[model samples]
Target: MQGEATGGTQTLADLQHWTWVLGRAQQMLLENGIHTMEAAPLSGWSDPSAFARASADFWTDTMKLWQRFLDPDSEGGAGEGEPAEHARDKRFRAPQWRQEPLFDFIRQSYFLIADHILKGVDALPGIDPRQKEQIRFATKSFVDAMSPSNFAATNPLVIERIMETRGENLLKGLQNMLSDMSKGQLTQTDANAFTLGENIAATPGKVVHRTPLYELIHYAPTTPTVAKTPLIIFPPWINRYYILDLSPEKSFVKWAVDQGLSVFVVSWKSADATMGGIGWDDYVEKGQIDAIDTVRNLLKVDSVSVIGYCVAGTALAATLAVLAARGEAAKVASATFFTAQVDFAHSGDLSLFVDDEQLAMIESLNTDGYLDGRFMAATFNLLRGRDLIWSYVTNNYLLGEEYAPFDLLHWNADVTNLPGQWHVDYLRDLYRDNLLVRPGAMRIAGVPIDLSSVKTPAYVQAGREDHIAPPESVWKMTHHLSGPLRFVLAGSGHIAGVVNPPDAQKYQFWTNPGETGSLEAFKVGAKETKGSWWPDWRAWIAAYSGEDVKANGARVPGRGNRKTYGDAPGSYVRQR
Candidate 1:
């Protein structure tokens, strides 16, 4: 039997209510710098046939859905299987969506419309890649905003919650909304459930070195014997370093220390007006390279193994190039990149936001000031709106409940500001121009930096599903380095892939069996490993790590010249 809508008066009221709520979703996009002005689509069709096909498909799908709505039992849509989308899209899996014909139609119709818009954008022809990206972003933003799951009346879950709580859930939701309004971020996890040093960034260590822009933490060795060469980790400044050091089980920092390596984490300071003028050279010199020198000096070693995570890996590649230029490339014993992209040619969705118009707009907003972490976080959240934005909207606000404690999500929320000039210069030079891949096309610290010149052996890894740095983008690193290169792919997205520990036995990883020239070739010849890549990395890195030395009482080695500023996870990470 078909589900019926309420009376005419109730219908009108619902129309007004939903209009206001959806209008708020659009408002959110606006607040996050996705202007509705850009959301206005192209005025003319450059390719008539592509759009013609889209229109035909759209009509065909619409008619099919209409037929299904009229006679749900009719032989239509995979014949008794839930709409193919149900298995894939988690948003409409609720029983009420299928049990009620009216909602079933709404759910199916929304998917059809979303698919039409996105696929239409994909099919749109003759538009330059950049322009097409902008249009696609605009259309996708619109489509994501108009999702039936966003509105109260349209979302059966919200209706179910409202009924169960005797309408008190609505009031609670309103209160949550107002609180989020004041706080200026959508709540993803319980903030109070975590404390930085105690539970999350809890790896025991000391801030052995400090600079205006970063704090270098030296973790005590967990084993009785340690590697002769120290390990310096340069995590992307966009996020705090704690991501690699989440809980003991998930903490890559802890795991590495347990593997008999002396680990040092660089906790970047959240940039502000004073640091706004700081550029890429300043970060490479004072941040990445400085940490290297400090660790080398403390450990009294000629060189150290270095790891860069995410964009920090890009910076490290540049720094290594600079070192190669300065005849100091040998200072770094080995280089490892975690889901990092040195070549931006195949960089994923993140590259979409670094175009000229967007960069100019960002510059205009910055005015020689730092890019706020919240702004960056907002943009990142929009990249996966269904998981990061819409899901939270449904779960927290609509369901009128608090989010569960999640350390990774909390670390994700703890974003760091990008220095203004550094932010613009690199995005323009590396991301937009794709200069990092081209030898001598980019420079750092007054040196013509070339990645290939830095003939240091490298281990580059990418998450198979990473949106920020696609596997193809990371694969291009094999071409950039002059020395030995080992590339690997891990399952899951950016953070999960890298943070995975061996004990968990969670996700799988892949390694090229033989000579791997490209991502596809690697996949074709790859051998799959059953668990985390940490152990594999440990085995790979062991060759580079020097002969083991007896552990020096679980203390940092030879810090004669460097002062111990404080305990591990220093104050820089504590900044918003």
Candidate 2:
């Protein structure tokens, strides 16, 4: 019955509702007998030897701690109290955690038990590695959910706030949760604080071209004279393209225009049931290729510099390979990739959730032809649970505090759905099979994609702390590209690293003079440079850009053979 419902067109809310219902049914079945059979080895406390070993270790550690506490004259006693080795852990940094010995004792005891339980589970006999991994991930999720820090009753900071507020905060927190639930979503940031065109994607531009797959945006030039070679940006369709054109001050699109470059951005349509048939080929042909053609037609230039971020970079690389095969490689003067992974072997923690079992489950949920954006958002939030999940939980629930409007978090919440076929194709071909880097393994637009054939001088930027596309994975593109490659390692995580503006001057970047085959060798030879990687990118991209020419005045809305669809952001970005 549930499967039948999933097969039809369902809204995110409907899908989530059915998911809950099915999940509960599964839980009930598991609780009866299936869990017992499957998790028999995981129930290690039932084993006498395992229980005894854990108990013995626990007692030994407790007794030693007790002895240390009692003996004033001991080597590290009252006169020289030893600090906890884990004191630096930010999670336990609350004043009450240290001021009250009881809290510390409780915390330490919890860790002790958790450690033993994990060890016992790990030592379980005859369990498959994949099953063991699933068990471990589930255990960690359970442990984290039950953490004292997550609950107002157990958290010291929450208790202090409660005492100060005289319980008013708790009521407010309940109200906030109820409000968010009413909207059928989780609250990450104060959504009410942001308006799309007015604040976020406010850069002046016009939607000069539109297709079923995307809207081609030509941003108004900021300089009297612009570079002859136009710059076309292909952003990941999984999220709104506004991330690059965020706010005027931090807008890469605006900055590029200011630098005397004609900037064109492709805004991908949020997928729906109508777009179910849209596959990887459609994205390349009707999406990137179409946008490139629009830019070329509008600017009347044969060659254009290109920029791609995250998944878009992967698609763009394939598009270039196809173009190169067709003898149209000169259409792209140079290419820039921001935190994009061409080689999936080192794709980081995101890979853990992409196994056969998980993919099958995902396929079931995507039976309606599109994966819900909210579902994708939840998966990403899990990647950094401490920052994206529990922190928000504590702020909105325990403290009853509303989130301050943050631009990046706001953009993150503004997600777009993926066509079912495209999503599965990406997971199967690139991630599961690791085929993108392999020549003749995959074909796009009827041409065999070979990354080695893509010899356009490339600029690749990877965030050192990026958990999604790890720097090592992004660096692998250097080995595949036959052209001159410059790889820069930026400080901070994925989004922040790419969005770093020169005026903000927050994160630094590392650069090596030349590309090396080995990622480790590149890192060793790289030198640290202060400030945003944007400047370095601009300089490199400009090198490939042709000489400055009189700026072609901004195209009038709905002018020429290709009429403007709407405003800069277009109708697609406002879908959700």
Candidate 3:
């Protein structure tokens, strides 16, 4: 169950076997300095007493688990909850995990030991907070890898499969592992299932503008009428912007256009060795500001509405801050942030890499002037290792099953490197020093970027379950922005929460129209709505956006003297 029906652990049932599987599927991912927490010495524990108590409890739980294995009907084996009732661990969902006394014991004992060790890790003192976080993250990875469900002997479902396939599954799994090794990356989705501009980034459009840093994609309008103020999205240079235009049914760009708006998206050029000299300022000037001004020229509109998803949202805040410093705050009529973090004080797991020591190590990753994209992709995968990693280990490698086509996973496997200096500047200034939200603490484009100085009307969306950009960190934007703002909480995490479409109606969002003292206070007073936040955003942005005109009007950006560079989902995105 480890979320992705990954098969068994290749008939081996030990830490080393699963570690090999984990390392195989997730090689080159943990090369970043943050994942390199030194194993804590067994003697030098910060809390010796706590460790002693935990060991005692672990043994007590182990003995009690044996009792429950002998008599599984008994209640409270270790501390609480039945094996099947685990809220997070889904690997033991098979009936054999519960019905077979030994498997049940293995499952319960595993959780007990994992929790015990983690509790001990949490209690470890005298370590740097960031180091502690790294240790915790590393510990969790080890614990997750060691789950019995990852082992063929312990996993009844896998044993059943091995028996059914006459051990063909293992052979097939080995071949699959070899294939992934050859590619030097795990195949998270069927490679042949989707194609760019064919099935995925299929929105009809042309690349109206291009820069070395990014391409401005002007999407074809769906409706006859278009907003007087065109909209441009500054997507995180971290991934493809096609996330907003993945497919017609799930495409936020298409949906926005149907609502009578001209939408332009920034397709950032993937960084490589040649792009090493580019820093944060290049993204601000050539990336955001250039794209904003280009859309304005094409549409002949003075003010353009903007949406920044994730890191781009952070960059948008900087762009706005720079504009405010230049007394050009009116350039952007409205701003929308999808899980962007301007304040890293409460940022999630990714923030663990912001330490001074880690910053240097990460900057050293610049092999040709940029950190490799594989580093970013792997780091994110580890953030949700159980689902993104170990599950695939069993399903694709050990279990010998091919994962079906998934647009999201395909996009995820698509890696993008960060400009070396830019990556260092972002983590050091914005994350390590927590400078972005502090007025004048950080300078961008030769100007002090003060988030509060940008008085544009804003709509901020955060995910309740987002780990990459925690709601608490995002909510701090409420206090940072000086403008009238609406904070909306979505039901899912980083990607799903933001990419949610209205038609699917798959997840819900919460709206607290007014400002609150904190994220928790906002949630307490928030009204939960059972649908996508797209419409809610449309209503907020529509007010700022001027009257709609015919989609074919001369005001629209076109194949005119502006020069149609190429089709949307341009050549840059096609760069590996």
Expressed as tens digits, the lDDT of each residue in 461-550 for candidate 1 is 989888878888888888878888788899997888888888899899999858866789899989999999888888888988899998
**Model 2: colliding residue pairs:** none
Summarize candidate 2's per-residue lDDT along 1-576 as a digit string, tens digits: 322221223244543443344334323433433345545544333444544465567557555544443453677542134346456656677766655444444455445545655675676555677567667766666666656678775576777777779888899999888987796567888888888889989888788887888888887777788888988999999999999988788888888878888888888999998888888899888888877877787767888899999999999899889999999999899999989988998787777788888889888888789999988898888877867888778889889886898887889988899998888888888888999989999988888889999999999999999988998899888878788888899999889999988999897998889646787888788889998988888888888898888775433234445667677787889996
> Estimated TM-score per prediction?
0.90, 0.86, 0.90
lDDT of 3 by residue, 160-215 (tens): 78777988999998998898889778789888889999999988888888878888
Error of 1 at 218 (Å): 0.5
State which candidate, 1 or 3, has the greater lDDT.
1
lDDT of 2: 0.78
Where does the lowest 10-residue lDDT sum fall in candidate 1?
A: 1-10
Q: Candidate 1 clash total?
A: 1
- For model 3, the superposed segments whose C-alpha errors exceed 4 Å read 1-47, 72-88, 126-128, 555-559
lDDT of each: 0.79, 0.78, 0.79
Best by lDDT: 1
TM-score of 1: 0.90
lDDT of 1: 0.79
